[model samples]
Target: MRFSNYFIPTIKEVPNDAIVKSHILMIRAGMIRQLTAGVYSYLPLGFRVFNKIINIVREEMNSIGGVEFQLPGLSPNELWMESGRYEIYGDDIFKLKNREMVLAPTHEEIFTTIAKANLNSYKSLPQIWYQIHTKFRNEARPRAGVLRTREFTMKDAYSFDKDWEGLDVSYEKHAHAYRNIFFRCGLKFFSVKAHSGAMGGKDSEEFMVEAEAGEDSVLLTEDRTYASNIEVAVSYREPVGRKNSNLSFEKFSTPNIKSIDELADFLKITDKSRLAKSRVFVNVKTNEDGTKTNEYILALVCGDDEVNESKLTVLFGLGLRPAHNEELPEITGADAGSIGPIGIKNPNVKIIADQTLKEADELVSGANENDFHIRNIDLTRDVNNIEYYDIRTAKDGETIPGTDKKLREAKAIEIGHIFKLGLHFSQKLGAYFLDKDGKENPIVMGSYGIGVQRLAASYIEQNNDENGIIWEGEISPFHIHLICVNPKIESTKIFSDKLYDELGKKGYEILYDDREDIRPGFKFKDADLIGLPVQVIVGEKNLNEGKIEFKLRRTGERFLIPENELIVLLNNYKYLFGFK
Candidate 1:
């Protein structure tokens, strides 16, 4: 590709709205242009890198016995309704006006529809189907360039199996393929156990790339043994030594105790663990008649811990929002900062307490009245309708549930996720396979996905410096960037063309900068900005000396070498030099 003919509009200055390193570099490199919020247009330079990543994902999927298909992104509402996800997805899904259809954010529903029509026997027990397609979602807040786009390319794969054991094998196969795919794409990443949100399943894992600009929180141990997304991560807290006072709940006047620290100071308790917080949440559902009804829940947790709504959603349902301030007064008979599960006015409200409060006693809680609190409250005697579960977010210093070590926190981007969606879609979609005994059973399913554009962006997040992106082999737009220093010089132009042809004959993809209008320094800046793996420069001085300049983008290591020696180096380390 000749730079004069190619549209590599490199920007020297960074955009103001861009916050992350990847976002800033992508625009500066002229790889992508924002068409609108949550949407982007990949330029020629960017499209090559995007396609390279896609090819790696495809190869890895094919290695794991995956059969590719082109599934339609525009899916009927009946398909999502049959799988019971139409209402669950809510406003995040892109729905057509009065068309009873949606632009698919994932292909599970339509893929299940395909499976139900074919592959109906145990003989087709384990099959893997996949597609590299565009997906759409109405992201409420789209930022970080390609990181959180509403429309992006996704490599989504689904596995079908006859039994739970077969599903395990299929899940492991995908795990292996994902590791290879990420490694080949020149990303440094790790896998963590994750919560199955929206895509409900028994076991879920996410491939994470640690970045300061990442949105997801990962709770892990120092040794990396217990790694998980914080949403479903479990923690251990040392038991607070206190016996039940066995006293009846006594109401006390505590003025302006809005926070747990204030409550602790008023009660003369050193630790805030003895204080409990009462929070009310409501999940609204669309009834059969098209009316919405609220399901009220009282969530109880230690003052030190916050609620992990992702975990809470498993026990309850989705679409949980904070109850309105007026509604809270009617349900709990108290305003905000003064409510508890004991003696609640609403009988239909469900109460869920964190497991840390299971053996709690002599605790201080709200009195369910204005400016009043209750003392000497025992969990067993004070709250009869409470169910204890781990609905609290994992604290940083808290020990692992089964170990004595504390948990460590990391901010990371989710690059890929694989879920063991056993019978979740198949049973709902009526995709049953006949066994040898002639009995029908739902096919166990697993869903795996990786965002192609996000992967390209994440690569820059981890592999870039102040200069620009330090693109690596197997995913850089081109294998070599050939720059002609003062291409207006006949000798420089002749030498640059000779080297470009030489590399091309060697099967290397080269981006040759043969423009006489651009200065040598400007061409070099664009070369570094684009971050092709290797760069070759043919200048008049180097041509006079019978040597050309070679530079490695990753290390910024430059060397002067003759044409014969450069060819020798290319042949000796072709793959290491990012040759195709």
Candidate 2:
């Protein structure tokens, strides 16, 4: 591809709105143009890199027995309703104006629907269906270019299996494929145990690359052995409560002490272990008759610990959320600031406490009255209908469970996720298969996804310098960037033209910069900015010496290769640079 013929409108200055390295460099390299706030148009150069990554993903998935499909991106609302994710996704999903259709952010529902239509029995026990397609999400704050876009490309796959064991095997296959894809795409990433979120899966793992602009927080041990997404991460269990078999409590007036910090300060308590923070939640269940039943719950955690809503939601249900301010008065008899289970006005509200508080004694809690609190409390004696679970967010510096190593945290971009979906989608959508015994059972499932654009941006996040992006491995826009330093010079142009043709004949994907009237200095800067891993410079001075300059964009290493020997060196490129 000649630069003069191709349409890469390279910019000298970075856009003011771009913040992350990928966003800044992509624009200057003329890789993408912003069509809207969160939408973009990939130029010819960008599309080449994009398609290369897709091809790599395609090859890996195909190796894992994945069957490719081109499903419609717009799905009917009935599919979402049947899966019970229509309300859970809320405003994050893109829906049509009439609310009858949706632009799928993920393909689990549609794939399950398709599985229900085709697969018959255990004969189709395990099948991986995949597609490389665009997805839509209504991101409230889309930033860092394609890293967080409303419209982007994704490689989504779903596996149908007969049972849990089959699902596990299918899940591992996707995991293996994901590892290969990331490695070939030049992305440095680690997998973390993650919550399935709205996907409603049993266990999920996220492949993430560390970056400053990342929206997800991941915790890792010193050896990087144990990793988890902060939402469901449990580094270690905190010891908080004293063993109190039976204890008593007394109500006390504590005016304007709403928050745990404020209450700790009011009581002059520095440790905060003796103080308990309470939160009220309501899960509204929609019945078959179109009526709703509201179930209220009271959650308790140690004063210093923070509540992880994801953990809570996973424990309860998707409808579980912090109760509204107005509804709190009706459910708990008091507002959020002073609501607890002890002597609570509501009898039906279930009390769920953090595991650390099960044996806790002499703990302080709310009085269930305005401007008042209860002290010297024991949960075993004072609270009824109580259960213990891990509902608190993991804090940094906490020791990993069963290991002395403390957890370290970093922000990372999530590139891929694979889920052990079990029977969540199949059961809900009535996708069942019959076994040899002739018993119809819900098909176990596994869902895997790789965000194509996110992978591109994440590669840039890890492999870039002040000059520009380092297009390495299979994701490079071009294998070689051949520059004609003096296009106006007759001898230089002739030599460069000949070399360009030779490079093409040698099976090198070369981008020839043969634009006349462009200064040598500008061409050099543009070459650096474009950042194709290998650069071949043909100049008048080098032509006279029977030599040409070869530069590596990544290492900035330059070599003076004899003009005739250059093609011989190019033949050894695959072993040296690992380019396609």
Candidate 3:
């Protein structure tokens, strides 16, 4: 690709709205342009890199017998309804104007429906179908460039099997394929146990890349053998010895003390372990017949800890949202700041407590009045009809379960996710097949996805400097950045043109800077911003000396090689600098 003919609109200044480095650099590099909030149009330069990532993904998926299909981006709303995900996805899913169509955020329901129409026997039991297509989501607040986009390309694959054992084998193939895809893309990533989220499944794992701008929080052991998303992470906590405080439950007048921090300060209490924090949630439960009922749940946890909503969801088997401040007065007859287990007069409301408070006694709690708190409240005796579970969010210093090593928290971007979906979609969509025993069963399925553009942004997040993005070897837009300094000069132009032609004939993708108008300094800056793995520069001075400058973008190592040794050195470096 010649720079003079290419459409790389490199900007001299970064966009003001761009907060993260990847977002700033991507726009400045002329790779992507935001059309609207959370939406972007990829320029030629960016699309090339994006295409390379897609190709890498395709190669890996194909290796695992994944048959690619070009599914429609716009899917019928009825398909989503059949899988019972239409309402579950809620505001995140993009719907068409007719209300009968939806942009595909995922293809599980569609693929399952396809399988139901086609496969009828166990002979076709194990089938892996995949597609590289655009997915749409109406992100409430999309930021971080392509990392969280409203519309982006996704490589989604689905596996169909006759039984759980077959599903396990299919899942392993995809898991191995995902590892290869990320590895070949030159990303530093780790897989961790993860919740399926809205994508209902029995088990799932996320491929995460550590980055400062990441949104997901991952907990890992020191050696990294055990890791999980914070929503379902488990940690060891030293048992708190039950203090022998024989104080009875008593409510007292405490003016303007609602929060635990305020109560602790007002009562001059130093130990926070003796305090219980109450939280209210509005849970939506779906019955077996597809009816949803709204209920109020009062959750209690240690004052120092916050509730892990995902754990609560798993416990109640329902979708939950934080109760609105306006709804609190009607549900619990108290404001959010002062609601407590003892103050709740409603006996029908479900109350769930954290396991940390099982034997806890003499704890401070809300008095249910406008401005009062109850001290010396025994959790076991006073809090009635309370179910205890492990719903506390994991923290940094907590020890790993059954291990002395402490858990470490990291901010990471989720690049890929693989889920053992079980019968979540297959059963709902009636995708069943007969086994060898001639018994009809729901085809066990698994869903695997890789965010193609997110992977590119994550690559930039992990490998970049002040200059711009440092494109990885395996998935770089181009392998070599060929620069011709003072291209107006016949000697410089001749040397660069000859080398670029020869390199291309040698099967190297080169971004040749043959533009005569741009200054050498400007070209060098563009080279650094684009960040090809290797740069070969031809200047008039070097040409006269029978030498050309070769620079490695990653190491900033410059080498002056004899003109005759150009092809030999480049051929050797190409192999030596290949991605692991």
TM-score, per-candidate, Cα-based = 0.94, 0.94, 0.96
By TM-score, the better pick of 2 and 3 is 3
lDDT (Cα, tens digit) per residue for candidate 2, span 1-580: 9999999888988788898889988889998999998999999988888999999999999999999999898999988888888977889899899769999988888888889988879997689999999999999989999899999999999999888888889998989999999988877789999988765778899999989989999999868888899998996776676755454688999888888889988998798867888888888778999999998888898888888899999988887889889987787777777877687788898899988888677988888888889898877677766899999889889988787999988999999999887888888999998899999999988888899988988988898888888877778888899999878999999999998998888778899999988998898888988898889999898789999998889899999989988877776666334554
- The alpha-carbon lDDT assigned to residue 234 of candidate 2 equals 92
lDDT of 1 by residue, 343-406 (tens): 6788888888888888688878788787888888888876777788988898787788677977
- Over 4 Å off, model 3: 287-295, 575-580
In the range 267-318, model 3's lDDT, one tens digit per residue, is 7877776678888888887889989888879988888888999998877665
Candidate 3, lDDT over the whole model? 0.86
After the best TM-score superposition of candidate 1, give how far the Cα of residue 453 lies from its true spot, in angstroms. 0.2
lDDT of 2: 0.87
Clashing pairs in 3: none
Sum up the clashes in candidate 2: 0
